[model samples]
Target: MQPPADLLLPDLDRTGAVPMLRQVYLALRAAILAGALPPGARLPSTRALGRQLGLARNTVVAAYDQLLAEGFVTGRVGAGTQVSRDLPEGLDAAAPPPPPAAPPAPAPDAAHRFRPDAAAHQPSALPFNTGRTSWDDRSQAVWRGLTLRRLARPDPALFGYGDPQGARPLREAIATHLRAARAVRCDPDQVVVTAGAQQAIDLVLRVLLEPGDAVWVEDPCYPALRAALAAARVRIVPVAVDGQGMDVAAGIAAAPAARLAYVTPSSQYPMGVVLSMARRLDLLAWARRAGAFLLEDDYDSEFRYAGRPLAALQGIDDAGRVIYVGTFSKVLFPGLRLGYAVLPPSLLEAVRAARLLVDWHPAGLAEGVVTDFLAEGHFAQHVRRMRLRYRAARDALVAALAEHAPALAAEPPDQGLKLLARLPAGMDDVALAAAAARRGVVARPVSPMFLAAPPVAALMLGFSGHEPAALRRAAWALGAVL
Candidate 1:
């Protein structure tokens, strides 16, 4: 017979000062690690655990939620929660072990076809990754407080599945915020909340493109966008971008029966060029002519450091071909995994159905907290503060690069958090990046952002997270590496 589930928890020592919930969590986790609670073992229900430990049911539930978030355990409908079947190797063992023996070698030309994108494999050590925020202690405290408050509410809906479209409060809040900040005209019914910008991209691809359909993407665009299109098995035609952004005439001329076109018009990634108004008009005309959907990834448009903020493509899209993708990752934090898409009326139902089938919806509590954050104006205030801070950092980076590495040419942009520094003709970006890593400065090569061939040798450095002083130091360190 199996041991009682309540007996799985370890006895607590009287002298420990740790919080009861934390102690219970650690003790239960320790049992799993020690194989005292083996794989497939069903954990006691929250009520039973609370009774066993003389704690509140809510405390046990919170512990379980943490475990679930961390992939330690899983809860199922009707069935009790159980330990994850694929625990880390040797984690269930009692003793520390040695390395395993090498496996047999593969035959030559073994048809091993899986190859990940180069950008995905690259080591990321930068304080501000693409679409990430500078999360300080205060933000963490706010998140914790919100989580605890949500936990206190007695709602079965919190534990069960949520509306695939997303929580109504968040969708409504996003609609209000976008209208005021981005000049986007939309209602709560038009907003479709997603896991992140990536998920929004995927949903758009699924709803708009069928297998073998053609799509046009910016030549040196975000690599993940390229990866997503490739995964969908759609043929992607690369449209070259100039200083003013993607060349509209060239894109129109090269259109190969494309069902959609993806562009970052506000501030192009890696290159950091805002699409000119004339070109934006020309591109929209082409979309109208070809009956193509345009995906506008407004990833980092919030922190425009130069001149007046440009109106979004969606705001100006009269032909109803633009699908606007926005995310809170840049403005608030990345790990929250909150993003939204404003779809054209024609594609709304199809995209909503696709989202329903794919992961149902984002976490309910996260949506609720973010909704409250935006409604209370904390989100807007934070964005304004970060915009100013990022501008200062951008200015410092440009000045430092000019002072230290005079030979290198740094392309200055009117807006966006990241800038590209064009390296000398023969210098290898990979080698320089490796050297910079040794000096504790992180930067990415722009070559990996290209599709067909490397069009330029440059380094993409983000200034959003680092302050001006830190950027100056990092620039000096990078100058040494180069």
Candidate 2:
């Protein structure tokens, strides 16, 4: 079929930012919608169109292909291409334009109140900030090599929207790794890959919680998790965490019908106390009796510097009550933004559906690279090397505290990344932290982490991000502030 002689072929731009094919496609699309090319108007064959427009056959074909895919045009076998008879509703000039997007509303007070960890806010900008990970030259080199390999031949399927649950290979890899490393019991089917532990916590709450539902949150816990729960309008029962971790009995007394409880069981945040084996059972028991779920945040449990890593609460759960959350942010790097939630079979469907509604899914490229990182043994290798390096840093920090500031008692964590140093009696930790920040060091106030009154006066100092020299220097400076 040949186009009419009087029909004007759209002009192509060779030097413009827009591709020649896209330009041709847009012009043809606009003409069809404007009724310049009416319904059932036969278009020239690909070769004829190319010759008429002085373009290669492929370019014209590509333009037509896009139009065909988008329903602006149609093609018939043994016939020719024509504009779609049943065009989209808005294509006609008589159709009303879509209403403009409403202006964004102002955020609530809580938006300003809930802050990320100090280390999350460009920790490298200052010295010895909490929650930062040490990235040595070897780790960076290995990461670069993995990234290049992953990019060398990216799967074409990744170009499209990925599975809401996560990439299958990544999930499978995580499941296998968790089973061996963290003693997490799960199949790939039960794993919901999330952006991070933060999102994993949010997703679980979205699935299980309703407005005003009772939720047991650890006192002096991770602020980001607290903010998320607060935003959901749940009644947060601040459960005390002692040497044994969350006081399960106090939580039962406070909120017996609580739908969920968030715990850093393996190593409690800031304090770094391992939840005792007895307490782990008590928590699991409470969840079973109350028909509640336990969200175990197994963050940084892999880097146990002393005895063996404490068993994760998720590992021992036979009642299918624990929703295990783990993140690569601390172990691998914060920017990776990769994490997983091992849900019980009962909650899998609801959680996966909820995840689809929020952000759809994480990027496939990052997941794939991490999948390869684990499968190729790089993850274990990195953890082994980092454990040794961080253990050294932790020891140096503790020793420096003993030498420089004997008043500030520092007990190194057997597991996890940071340590809690108790301040002098009546010394305001918030004021001390502010003072320390001004001196180019981060001593996160422990009182703010507490939800109940009469909070402990302490500072949380991280040693994982810095070398021994920097850790020692930061400790000496903190002593001067005290």
Candidate 3:
């Protein structure tokens, strides 16, 4: 069949980082999947396509070969190439075509609600955005090398459904790392690998909570965890946090019968307060008395700046009531989507069962690569390098805030990626964040982290993702907004 006169060729971005052949493949694949090219429709010959697109025939061949290998197209002698008649699932010709692309909509009103965390890491987005963790080129190169090595081995275990509690080797590696770094005490058998801390928290809540059970949450807690608890149909009692972190007595007074309490002990989220040892013991005692479990999010414990890093809450929990959760998102790259939960001996079987039913384990390839990362000493080296770099960034950020935004005050925490600055009295942090976002600086409001009316206005500014200079620039921008 002759090429359709109106068939639009894929637009290539010559300066883009994507390879030309891969771009061609993706465009053709999209056209086929979108029904722009009908099933069994003939594609131009490689030679013809190369000529039409003004390219070398080998480049066209490379694109066509990839499509053929992926079953997106088929070729035969004399018939040339055609869109695959047996399309992959959900790409059927009989399936309704997607609606035409809508024209770009007008920008919403300035007061329109926007999620501050969603676009923090966009290529063009502002720097110093909360929850944005940096992955340097060197680290990415290391990860790529590790990933290639894993792919070369072609493990049969990775090809099959992974162990629900996670790969044994990976679990062992995690246990060893936790033992050394965070002082978490657990056997490999007690660990359950999850698709990041979010899923880890979700799995724990699934196994532990019944409908409408009261759970204690830090007043200004991680929003994602709160959402998970709500989804599980649990009542959340928001307990206050101070310099000592979540007040155990306050939590007891708020929800004495609460079945579980989620706390970030090493470095509390949003507000970078390390739960004092006294408060840690107090919380543990409360949990024991109430016969409840503590979900300890040991997120970002690796980036301590000032003093020696505090031991994990789970380390001192002799009562076996603490479920220690940790993630590679902050330490490594967030896209890795790898995290683990160290369950107590009592809850191990139930959590494993829940994990099996929930996603049946995280991606085996990531688990395997990360296992190698931890075992081969790359993980420790990377963390040390990041710690130094982030410490510098944090110091610069604090200095900039003091110089530029003197109205805001923040004491640098010994650990974690973000610095929480208390806003001036009567100032609206949410509004300030919105304004800063409009001006291309992502400043997250601490108010939304609260369950009730926030007692004070605050902003959580991230420093780990940006360089010292970039952090200064973001700080200057934030000061202007304030």
Candidate 4:
């Protein structure tokens, strides 16, 4: 064995501008690279080196610590420190970087279809941004408390891998909440927790429909749902929406053999029309006869301004035809990204398996917090409080529209976040929306939302997420543009 003192380090430069620690580190690194200190050669202990160089022991130790971190040296108890047996390759400082190379193509599945769009990210405190919901201060404090409590508990499962089907306690709580509030027919075993309603929709599509297989979606439906379906590479059959909601008769006429139908029955997105009870029965009957499935997105059904929210389409579903999807994002907050699907016995395992294939499960910590919220009745309480706040904001928007822009036909929706305001006949809704955006408002044109029924010239203004004063101010600015 070579004695540690035989290692020849440079003389200490204590009087120079460079820190003694940095100089020590640089000297050792250079020695290792130049082969002055060969691989596996012993290094002097910090005390011995500091005494020889007349520097502090900490400076020498600091240099050795860096060398160890960078794989230039290794240390072990009793054996002391030595040069690394396997040193990491280092690039020559004068060498040029290699040329950029093209990436390989993605897999031939729906994975290739996804790309981020700004529409989901655009909802904000800005007036008329439809994807947001109003929040309260006290409720936020309560939510923070629940989250902290989850971390304080000493549970080993918190760090372990969780079930792909989601935590059983949270599923049980979600099942109970759905049964009581939306009248959904399911047990805890039937629910599969997901990142949000969007994931739940994607999972159902990939499992049930093949590429080019036809699926019926509501015209003027949620844009994100359409994006998911297109990403799955399935043929989307756009059915028109009437005052009664999705025209089921037109769908059957167009493609009765379609594998699935996605609808928001309780409150149609953007249009805000509840599916008539007669139509609901007819759709359910059609699904059973055709051996197809209906995905009921009960997204904002909890905050209806009318007497009470309507029962979910799943409640009336028999023959295992309905797959119910819902999210806690709206009532709690959007960032929570917690949503669930109540699957029929026929599709339970398939969806859970698809979930595993896509992403192994929702965050366990978030699941735990939601479970406590639902079981403690905090979820229901939060919904009740938000309903009143949203109603006030809705009223403000309606009054502002009528007062400021009378040419725009507007009506207050009974139970949804947005309202449809008809523009003057022959006016360009797209141009109008662009103008609104330039004026610091987010207005969505309704013409693009249509399937084929002569496009209606209208704009969709969201009301739930803005304050009354802010809504009024936005409406006044919107009037000037109109």
Given candidate 1, what's the lDDT at residue 250?
Answer: 76
lDDT of each residue in 1-482, candidate 1, tens digit only: 23364465667654657777788888878877887777778888889888988888998998988888878888898777888787876785557576798898885552332334665543354632344456656566766777677778834778888888888888999999888888887888888999988899999988888878888889897888887887788888888888889887777778745789899998897788878999888888888888888999998777776665777889988878899999987788777788999988898898889999988877988888887788877777777777777777778889999987776788666777788888998988878877887887777878878876457888888777776777788888888877
Pairs in clash, predicted candidate 2: none
- Candidate 3 similarity to native, TM-score: 0.75
The 10 consecutive residues of candidate 4 with the worst lDDT sum are 87-96
Which regions in candidate 4 have their CA more than 4 angstroms from the true location?
1-27, 30-45, 48-55, 65-93, 96-112, 115-117
RMSD of candidates 1 onward, in order: 10.7, 7.2, 9.2, 4.1
Q: TM-score of each candidate?
A: 0.74, 0.76, 0.75, 0.86
Candidate topping TM-score? 4
Candidate lDDT values, in order? 0.80, 0.85, 0.84, 0.87
Best by lDDT: 4
Better by lDDT, candidate 4 or 2: 4
**Tens digit of lDDT per residue, candidate 2, span 1-482?**
34565558566667868988988888888888887787778878888878878889999899999999998788989778988878754555686688999999998876864555543355353556766787778878888888888789888867898899998899999999989987889999999999888888888988899989999988877878877777788898999988788888999999998999989988788677778888889989999999999989988989997777767789999999999999999998888898889999999999999899988888888888888889989889999999999999999999999988788878877887888889889889899988988888887888888889359999888888788998888888988987
Clashing pairs in 3: none
The sequence of per-residue lDDT tens digits that candidate 3 reaches over residues 187-246 is 899999988888888888888999899999887888777767767778989898888999
Q: What lDDT does candidate 1 reach at residue 113? A: 24
Q: Number of clashes in every candidate structure?
A: 0, 0, 0, 0
Candidate 4 residue lDDT tens string, 1-482: 46456567787676778889999899889888876677788888888888877788998999999999998899989897888878644522345678788798768875768754446468456888876876688778878899899889935777888899999999999999888988888999999999988888888987898899888999877778887887778899999999999999999999999999999999887688889999999999999999999999988888889897899999988789999999987777788899999999999989999999999878988898889888998888888899999999999999999999988999998988889999998899999999998999998887877766778889998887788999999999999999
- The runs of at least 3 residues in candidate 2 whose Cα sits more than 4 Å from the true structure, single-residue gaps closed, are 1-124
Using TM-score, rank the candidates from best to worst: 4, 2, 3, 1
Better of 1 and 4 by lDDT: 4
